[model samples]
Target: KFPGVPRVERVSFNKGPLELVRHTHMASLGDAAHFEVDYVDMPAGFNDPDLSLEGGISGLTHALEAQGARVLTKEKVVRGSCEGRDTTLFLPHPPRKEGFVEGRAFGSGQRYYFLMFVGEEDGPQLREMARTFMESFAVTDGCTAQPAPTPAPSSPTVVSVVEGTHDAATGWRKIENTELGFGVLMPGAARHESEQAQVEPFPITHHTYINEDDAGVYAAEVFGEYPPNFHNTPGSYETMLDVTLYAMKRNFEPSGFTITPLRDLKAGTFPGREFTVTNEKLGAQGRTQIYVTAKYIYVFTAFTRGQAAASAANALERFFSSVRITTK
Candidate 1:
């Protein structure tokens, strides 16, 4: 299925009455993408052949909804059944929602759930991947885990060439730009990039600052300014927050890290969300935070390699909390 930079992983687990088996596949940098298909078996005693799966949240549907809330946006769902098994599919926006389609099967003794996630990039192939998965979803009377597939031949990896241009002196320092009307704390010199977003009819400038930690890992603080009073529009602030967070994820993804949003990030006027970042190849893990202002949006995130979450956690919290926006 993975024609480009083919790499895939599979794992299975059984926890008393709960069983989960997942298959993860990865592609190369340019066409970088992640696709995972999950099979879940739970001990839920639901006995009703004519039950309405979409009537209300209960049993398998209830559990499916809970998981959907985490991975998918709070959008309306497509309801029906797959192979006579009641199903609820969550079609979240790509790149942001990371391509999650959730469903479940109702049966006595042991119920089943099917979930497929595709992220990083989207195209016709990914849609086909989803279609094929759902078309094959069903309840297996005697399902068993398959042996791990043999590893494919190694291939060359692609890395980012964007290097830090900030020549400021070393040591943790406060980065400020009065012209831009914002300041932030950065571990070291940060690379800067500016470009016009690919938009039809109209386009806006986008700016990003990326800095590196002592461990050779990198962190980014991205900000983009829009037209006058653009943030005044209804839901403008929320839109900026969501778009900024998604941009930050795309920024880190090229380096082989996976990101997942955990919340909507709202408290009064606070305009940002929290995210978890992981890199299985490097064993690095940490969180992401980004705050949006009236006319400016920013994202600052970092992760530590082979260490506890403490190092990256402190930096991330400090970096995000220390932001001061004059325009806000």
Candidate 2:
């Protein structure tokens, strides 16, 4: 991917000046008239052989047909059981024409779908561009896909904070904060704390969950009113993220620090940014997600230290995956 955004690109794929763009919608492609690719990262334990790679390509073709397109050729390509299909689509009203070639591939525990279209007369070029883009496409190692969020149940009962050992019989316990309008699954008996602070003009409420024995900490901060000046429009989101990261770096003051590029992510239904930070000298690692909603901004963070950090990996993932924003 291209650092923070959910975009992947290759420098020189073809002579037609081929470009690849991935997103949820066509209009979102903007000037990317070359190719449109959409990729989804399946969650851990999603190994189902029945969901063949061909099925994925077929589904995309069906979707195009639903949008008033005619398929011309459909066949399998030799790339981890990949498949490619070509179609002709007519624009609404005056029937302006275009041709599309789509391809799908599943391998190395990930899924990818790409669609490229141009004028009907340029069908040959469009097919060549799609082939080259797919051939060069790759997902970087150690960069797993983020699975789709599971829908939370309605009217979930809020679990009260209990002291002493957690009930292992029940596994992880759910802790909900009605005030902050969010909930998370705690690893075990966790200490909870909350406080009010000023994040600029906004009054922010911070909540923390800590497992002392495991040396794992999960935290959430809710801001009532985000600064209007921090609005993330196009290139501005990076600036806001930089401000946040700078504050974090100063607060930690680590001997060695490394941070991943900010990536657009989702917390339940809320869109957000997810990133990782590590302090090798301190043996500390953290994953943080920040969401900006219409009325509030939410920041969720998880961190662990030392040897215990290794064992806490599963717990940390569970804690993050189980998070649900309860408020509308």
Candidate 3:
């Protein structure tokens, strides 16, 4: 069990001859935050001595970035000859009151990913918790030397809402919303709503589209004046992009979601950032795209869970591919 985190529950998964542990604490409060520790088996052929600890971490960072995550900081910690890599990542949408932090380590022939969150004011305490957890961790070589069984498939319950005629072959319809300045192909009736939101020093308009059924939920948010600090200069726009991304990160923190690194993305002619996040507790996963134009920021998000998540692959592909940004 990890120190300082009470009531830790240990869960395990089997991958062929290898077994991994996932330690979780579902209920925590105050300076203490939600914490989890994952032990992963190194893939076969990954035991290369020439692959220095830093190189391994760099590879991991690159993989994360490829998946649309942004790495905030990375450092090396020496625990004797067993060198470990520590990294911090930004969440996609952080909570309003608290910040999210994920501390990961790989060394001693073992890989571990630790998750903990802190209030904006509890940075020091969060670091202490991470240090304590890392210091107390130990790697074990315990596994049944046998191939694991193939898991059975799951039957998912999906509910979808659709209006108007659907194509017999594709089961979808085209949707064009001129007010939102975008068009997409969807599987259901898209509900649109507008709200006023405070994005730092300015009040912005938010247009949202909601389409959900048992299968999954597809949402797109068009944020008016997203980077409230944009000044038209190259440097200023870059700063505004950072600020906007930070705000998005904060929005996702409350759900305890793990985000992939942010990667360069393009929405038609507009270049932007994209990433995906998974919330195990909610049994849901999402892909998000953030695009900023001269006047607004556009966020496209798709969410699904369980069987629906896996089975809706085709629909999701068509929906995203059909997205056309009509605003300048």
Candidate 4:
């Protein structure tokens, strides 16, 4: 947001290698009040291994120095509970300016950069504003994290391996329907169930693979060859996924249910949605992610007895990541 800068312009371009969106908010009068955020996805092999927090900070320092800017200070700090570096830069150009830079690294070669530039570094008001802005930064929605359970989850991390792998600690095994062209990794002991439906538009079938432990339940459902029109309509994939979610939301039996929509997700490159549902009628709570591949839709759900089953969180994450869909 540009402060009192009435004319703010936004430009988005999908063609270039740089970031897709940019807000050109800084004033050419050199007032020095500037704040900008950007994301960079550094591919794994692109000068990384050095693409992490420390490496990023070091790189920024060098780039700033090349522009006649002297680095005033650099220190490692935990801002917003994320590991990052805080650096102050002094640029002695025609428009003398000083700025602060904060950089945070996300896994899989992603990085978030926060930059604030101002006319003078000695101004207490400007320094206070920059400090507050950097310290308050947070990742929400897709990256917002829920608090850990008081006792922590019993299986906070499920290190599962695909079938035929030599490791026994891989608590999961792979299940594939070659005919269906999809493969999934499920808890080692899950079994399959399928039924054909005599519905309108033909070839409709329902498949479910499920298993339960004393503490929880894990299940995946497949909706094969659903109504063709449903998939053919524009935006139908998301619409149909929403419809499925609605069906899950409304069926709480005798009582109403509470639903929390989590972040949207992708299975490999396929689109998906993730959410949690509470079936008040059954006193059950679960997290589910559903993905689609042309003719087949996959729904993975992991649930336990109550509202906060931390133990199932990792399992749900793993289940979503395990999906492999080849149809298109």
lDDT, candidate 1, 1-328, per-residue tens: 3435445566675422334454544443353334333333332222222232222123334344444533332222333332223333353454564444434333223333334343333456765665665455444453322223233234322223343234254346666667666666666666666654422212334566666654534444444454455443334555555545545565778988898887655433656677888888988876776666655565656667766567656666666666665654
Clash count per candidate:
0, 0, 24, 2
Per TM-score, the best of the predicted structures is: 3
TM-score for all models, in order of appearance? 0.43, 0.41, 0.46, 0.43
Predictions in order: lDDT: 0.49, 0.51, 0.56, 0.56
Model 2 C-alpha lDDT per residue in residues 1-328, reported as the tens digit of each score? 2112334544322211222233332322343233445555433323432232434445555555656666666554444334333333432223544545454544444444444443343356655654565566554552233343333334332333544334355477666667667766666555666554432223344455555444656665555544443332332333334345545565655557676656787645545788886767767687877765544566677777774655757756876787677645
- CA RMSD for every model? 19.5, 17.8, 19.1, 17.3
Candidate 3's residue-wise lDDT over 1-107, tens digit each?
A: 44454665777754223444666553345544555554444443334322334443554455445544577887865554445666665434344433435555544
In angstroms, give how far residue 80 of model 1 lies from its true place.
19
Candidate 4, position 27, lDDT: 34
Candidate 4, residue 98: the lDDT equals 49
TM-score of candidate 1 on Cα atoms, chains taken together = 0.43
Which segments of model 1 are wrong by more than 4 Å? Answer: 1-171, 198-200, 213-220, 231-233, 246-256, 262-270
Candidate 2 wrongly placed segments (more than 4 Å): 1-170, 199-202, 225-242, 255-257, 268-270, 308-310
- Per-residue CA lDDT of candidate 4, range 1-328, in tens? 3444434456664311223444443432255555554445432223222224444455556556666677788776654445555667776655544444433333222434444444444467776766665555565532332222133224332223224222245567776767767666666656666665323224456777776775567777788774434343334455456546655565632375577888888756656888886666666777788776667788777766653556556666666677676755
In lDDT terms, how accurate is model 4?
Answer: 0.56
